[model samples]
Every structure is written in structure tokens, then in C-alpha cells.
Target: MEAFAVPGLPEFETGDDIATAIEAACDLRGDDVLCVASTIVSKVEGRTATLADYPAGPRAREIAARFEEQTGEERDPRFAQAVLEESTDLVMDEPFLLTETRFGHVGVNAGIDRSNTGGAELLLLPKRPSESARRIRERLSVDASVVVTDTSGRPFRHGQTGVAIGWAGMPASRDWRGETDRDGHELEVTVESVVDELAATANLVSGEGDDGTPAVVVRDWTFGDHEGSENLYRSVEGDFVRQALREWHYEQ
Candidate 1:
């Protein structure tokens, strides 16, 4: 399969149409998977915000003060308030703000972007990424799958890679469980995250900082005969790492 970015996409505005913009820029096939940067999706969805928009309450002020005292970096109470407002649960709050967004996404500072905000102070993620992907897919002329992607740091990973926060017209993963391996042994537990892998491939050509190519088309790639599954995020009840973190006390 080959992947290339769609060129000539302009700086998106609040009311811009992403589906039409991408459709005009390139010809997409039904089999092609379109990976879109969440930044552009949030831009067009008008998820931009300013720090002043969130008034720092007592809780926000406390969190900010504790953050500054522990990290030795000044923390803004309004910024803390913004993260708090965007999150439904705080996974971690000491060294950094690791929280679960409203739509089940877990990320630092609620995955708020400070860059490429179209002059706004912040760029919040789309309220519902899968819904955003579905909307974009329905607007397209062809039946292409859409993956709404974002770059994020992962546990035990040194740098950030593209991850699928929302997807449409396709399953999230290819389940390899119960399949035979190279040695003819039954594979008990193996699931390939197709959307995240496609998102990473898209990012290889999507460009960063000023590349202006936030959308990429991946052609000729197929899911083959593997069974598909839509299980990406882990539930707290089954997530041992999260459980340990919740029970373990921090030194600081």
C-alpha cells in the first residue's frame, strides 16, 4: 500500500468544510483509508478556546498551585480549569495532568493543543471523534474510511506517534486471537490496531510544524480476511495498570 498527503489544504477556519476540502484536493477511492489530523478536525468544529474563557475555581487553583510546587514550573489556574472542564476523570494529577476526556480518551492536559489554534489560546479536541469521522465520511462522495488521528506520547515510549481517536467506515482492529501462528500454534491473544497503525503511516507523510498536510490517503491497503474488532480503550475494571496507579500512593 502507498500513502501520500493531500496537498493545498488551507489553514482551516471554524466554519470550513473538511470533507469538501479534501475531496477537492485529491481523488479518493472507496478502498482508500483517509487519515485526518485531529487538529484540523477540531479547528473546523470550532473547538478553540481561550484561557480567559475558563474562570479558575477553588479546585482549579489548588491543582495549579500543587502542580507548580511539585514541578517547579509555573502553572496557570485557568489552564488547569480548562483541563478539568474537559475531563470526566483525573487519572493522574501530581507530576502532570493525565485525565480521561469526555469521550473516553485518556491524555495529558485533556489533549489540549497550544499550537495551530487559528489565533485562539487553545485548541480542544473534538467532542466526539468517531462522530466527527462519521460526519466526514458521509460527506465524502466515495465510501472511504476515515480515521481521526492525534499525536500522543505512550507509556514506555520515548516519543509521540499518531493514534486514532476516532474512526468511521471501518473496524478499529484486526483480531488475531484463535488464529494459527507461523508454527501452527493457536494465537491466544493478539490484536492489531489497524486505525492506529494507519494513523502512524499517515503521520510519516502528514508533516509536522508547517507541512500543511494534515490529511493523507492510504491506497491499496486492505484488511484481508482477518476478523475485525472495535476494542481500543481498556475499561478501568480490567486495566491493571490504571488500578495500580489509583491504589499506589505518590511520594510527593
Candidate 2:
């Protein structure tokens, strides 16, 4: 499997045709998987907010005060307000707020990003990432798959890695149920998140800072037909970490 970036993309803006830009930047082939950063997708979809757009509300100020008091790290209330507005539920408030986004994604600050925006602007995750990927795939001339990716920190893990937020035209997970192992042992509960793996691999080529290459084309791999990254999400009831945290919060 080989992955390379589609370079020479100009700074994206609201209403820009991202599919056209991607096509212009790279020569796409059938069966290729395109991994695109969520920042560009948010930019094109007009999912950006400025300080002026999200003024600090009373709740924002309260949350900001609590955050600063706990972490001793000062943060802007307006930014906190923006994060709250983008989130469907707030799981934690101190250190960093772990929020469930409107799209059902649970992460820090509801995936409200401040980096890579010019100035005083915040980028939110795409309203519907799967739809965005599907649209981009339909617009491109070649038959290919698309995965919308974002940088995220994992629990009990240091540093950050790329994760698939949305995808189209390929199975997000490859279930190996009823298969055999090296010794012909029956395999169960061995589903692999191929989309996230591709996203993480593609990020190796699409650097986080100033690289200007937000999209990468991965070739030389075969994929089965599927849709979206919904299979990747764990329900709150079934998530041990979240359930434990909820119990701890209640006890506190």
C-alpha cells in the first residue's frame, strides 16, 4: 500500500469546490482511497466561527472560570462558549472538556479546532462528515473512496493520531468472524477498522503544520464496498471508559 499527498492546494474558503481542487491537484485512479482532513471540509462547508460569532455567554464564563481554576491554564470564554454551542453534551469540564458533538462524536471541545485557521477563527467538524465524503466521491471523475479524518488523542495514550470521522465507498471495518487464523483456529471479535488505519497512514504524508497538503491518495490496496464510519462508534452504554467515568462523576 502506497500513500502520497495531493499537493499544491490553495487555502480553502467557504463555498469552494473542494472536489474540483483535489482533482486539479492530483491524478486520481479507480479504487484509490482519498483521505482528507476535516479542517478543509469544515472550511468548504462554512463550519467556521470567529470570536465575534460566539460571544462569551454567562455559562461560557462559568465554565471558563472552572477550567482555569482546575488547570491553572487560562482560556478564552468565547472559545469555551463556541465549544459548548457545538457540543450536544459535555462529559467533562476540567483539564479539557470531553464533549459529544452534534454528529455523535465524543472528543475534546466537540472537535472545535483553533489551529490552521488564519486568525481569531475556529473550525468545527463537518455537520455530516459521511455526506461530505460521499459528495466528494461523487464529484470526482474516478471511482474512488473518501475518508474524512481528524487528529485526536486517545485515552491512556500519549501524543495524537489520525482517526476517521467520516467515510464513503469502503468498509470502515473488516469483520473477520468465521475466519481462520494461522493455525486454522476460528476467529471471532477480530474486526479491523480499515478506514481509521488508512486515515492514520495517510496522515504520515499529510503533515499537521503548514504542509498545505490536506489530502492524500492511497493506492495498491483492495477494499470492500461499505459506507460511513458509524460502525467505528461505540455506544455510551457499551463503552467501558465512558461508563466508568459517568459512575465516578456521579459518586463525586
Query: Would you estimate the TM-scores of all the predictions?
Result: 0.97, 0.93
Worst 10 residues of 2 by lDDT: 243-252
Clash count for candidate 2 is 0
Q: List the lowest-lDDT window of 10 residues for candidate 1.
A: 243-252
Best by lDDT: 1
List model 2 lDDT by residue over 4-49, tens digit each: 9998999998899888998988899988999999999999898887
List clash counts for every candidate, in order: 0, 0
**Which digits, one per residue and each the tens of the lDDT, describe model 1 over residues 1-252?**
999999899999988999999999999999999999999999999999999999999989999999888879998999999999999988887778888898888899999999877889999999999999999999999999999999888788798889999999999999888899789999977899999999999989985688899999999999888899988888889888778777765577
* Model 2 deviation from native, Cα RMSD in Å: 2.4
lDDT of each: 0.92, 0.85
